[model samples]
Target: MAATLQLNTTKWSLNSNQSDVLIKARHSIIAYISGSLNKFKGSIDMQNNEVEDACIEFNLDVKNQESTLKNIDSPLYINDYLDSNTFPNITFKSTSFQKISSNINFLKGNLTVNNITKTVELDAQLINITIQNGTKTAIFEISGLIKRNDFDLVANAYNHTNGISLGQDITLTANLEFVI
Candidate 1:
């Protein structure tokens, strides 16, 4: 039998809070801003002695982007830094999965934003797979970090503000769900 497509919609969250805004201030006053993945799709396959192929997709909606501090995000959202009006979404599509073992795998794919495409690799592990109500399901906990500047997500920078600096290097942490 062929592997089944298990995921209807998976989640990938981007945290702006982790970004540091470096401004000249007596101390840093930066906090975390967060956003959700409004458009995402992926599938999971488990069969035979090994897992089958898989794919994942992601889309970023600028208007949907939100942050902890309204002052920080509203202006930044409108700036040339993000340029949401021009480029509405950032996207990712997985090409393939190379399973290393029963538990670990490598998810390799292309990520695109602002018309730039880059190769990305993610280390994914199967936390558990379960069967309930005549359906099979899989859950994976994924964690990785990507450079924000690589995709040119930098915006609303400051010269001096408290001790906070708008910094790059965003961390991606997520719990995914799928069913077949």
Candidate 2:
């Protein structure tokens, strides 16, 4: 008699304390400014220990961002740029998650920001997976580029001649940890 292996779907929750979500954009056409989104929640559904048919959903608190730019008070102000007062959340729901290689995957989803929804594709890399104390944990790094103008994330009354013009392209990177 041959033994058959049973594969079941598992749901994983994001460990926000062990994760980091960052955004980088060009500042004044020379320097760059970076910021971190501190509060977020997400989940992943995996079957047979693979990401080929995984479903990912994430939500970020726009009002909880922290900037890394120094000497400036309220760098990338929430109301000035993101208008967090109107839209307090940035959300993503994956339509498909395809594995390209053993560690590389492509994630296509609808990203909603500032009340605008757009389809975006991001690169996902499996960093590591570990089993500790009968718990399964997985770490992944997700990254991609998005345009600020596409989502109306630009400030209307900003002075451009003062060497403070923000760039259109914004790079987003998230190091996410999930536990099952």
Candidate 3:
């Protein structure tokens, strides 16, 4: 069956404009500050504008996660942090999406990382649905905040010299392009 999107279905992908994944301490010795990995790969399972019954999932390559001081791809497999060898990928599955205000929607889902699963709620706005070049594409902007410690990312290296944080708060912004 062909895709039932608002436009001609073609290729779709996920992109992020700004993502701040940081870990800091009270004394202000920052452990790490990552701008964006830009290595996230995922798909949207759209059955039209209704995402209520849809199953959306994403897999983030841990090895590609970068920081202000370095590229910690290899370190992701280490014992202190992500431990990508055992976990491999960070993932999320949407449970539901709800329309609240006229231009606001809430996406509720479970995010799994480092063998820990946590519920995350994201606020999103459907930017526009436009048809161009015989293809219909839907653009959306999403934002959210999460605690790294909640996902067991407990490397507090900035705190105790071996510890990485007072707490790590991750702020994310994503731009998704989809074909209907």
Number of the top TM-score candidate: 2
Kindly state the number of residue pairs that clash in model 2. 0
Candidate structures ordered by TM-score, highest first:
2, 1, 3
Residue 150 in candidate 3, Cα distance off native in Å: 1.0
TM-scores of the candidates are 0.60, 0.70, 0.57
Please give, for residues 1-180, the per-residue lDDT of candidate 1 as tens digits: 999886434422222222121111112222222323245567666564235656666565544545232333222222234445667665668888888887788888887756678888877766666678985666664445566577776532554323234445545444555565
Ranked by lDDT, the better of candidates 1 and 2 is 2
Candidate 1 achieves a global lDDT of: 0.52
lDDT (0 to 1) per candidate: 0.52, 0.68, 0.54
Best by lDDT: 2
Ten contiguous residues minimizing lDDT sum, candidate 2: 28-37
Steric clash pairs (candidate 3): 5-180, 7-136, 8-136, 155-164, 156-163, 156-164, 156-165, 157-163, 157-164, 158-164
lDDT of 3 at 180: 44
> Lowest-scoring 10 consecutive residues by lDDT in candidate 1?
17-26
Error in Å for residue 89 of model 3:
0.9
Q: Model 3 lDDT vs. the true structure?
A: 0.54
Residue 125 alpha-carbon offset, candidate 2, angstroms: 0.9
After TM-score superposition, what is the CA distance of residue 29 in candidate 1 from its true location, in Å?
12
